[model samples]
Target: MNTVTPVRFDNVNVGDALPALDLPPLSRLTLALYCGASGDHNPIHVDLDFAKEAGMPDVFAHGMLSMAWLGRALTDWVPQSALRDFNVRFAAITHVGESIRCTGTVTEKFEHDGERLVRVSLATTNEAGVQKLLGEAVLSLP
Candidate 1:
């Protein structure tokens, strides 16, 4: 059963936290598949030898892959139509076999131009609590 806890605009408040999204531990196959799907084809993400040649200890997950995870978490919480703007910056490299958790906190809620709006601060962190992605998103509510 797919259970979705609906987020209603009227009940939202500043500082409200969104339900978190947990992803399975990342893997080499996952990174390779993501590379194929995203057309990134960056050797640094999928080729261990290339990554080592680049001075990295191992191949790393693409920043956008983690960003996509964060976006999926947000849209899963509320309807995608409610999303007005979303942006993120990569904070640290996410490597294979790391667990990622996507989380968000409502930062502001207000009415603008007769539209209900909420701003959320978002983050993706690994098992060690190292932040891999820092981001913000704006939602327009009905």
Candidate 2:
């Protein structure tokens, strides 16, 4: 099994970027599964006809699913307990069959309430490098 070396607070510094992670390519089945699991069965995410009627070329992925993938990338890098806050804004729609890459750069670091914390600028991009999500996160480190 692959093991992750925990990131130590002392070893991390402002401007240190976490390695980029690429999620599996999004497919129609993936969208359908997300709709089922999240209970966000919005037709826009699973119905091509509904989406086209809504002026979109085809059904697209839910923004929350991309956000969840971003969260997955973060938690994979550091233990979930290290996450203090994470928020994102949907920048663009992610279409099916597109691969997404999640990346983050540490923007700042400080000690608060005896805890060493870091702020990171996070983003997800499509294979063509189009930004899909934009946001920031705060993490508590050990």
Over 4 Å off in model 1, which ranges?
1-5
Alpha carbon deviation, residue 67, candidate 2 (Å): 0.6
Error of 1 at 78 (Å): 0.9
lDDT of 2 at 80: 87
lDDT tens digits, residues 1-142, model 1?
1126567788888889888999999999999899999999989998889999999999999999999998888888888878889999998899889999999999998878788889999999999999999999999876
lDDT for 133 in candidate 2 is 97
Question: How high a TM-score does candidate 2 get?
Answer: 0.94
Question: What are the Cα lDDT values of the candidates?
Answer: 0.90, 0.90
Estimated TM-score for each candidate: 0.93, 0.94
lDDT of 2: 0.90
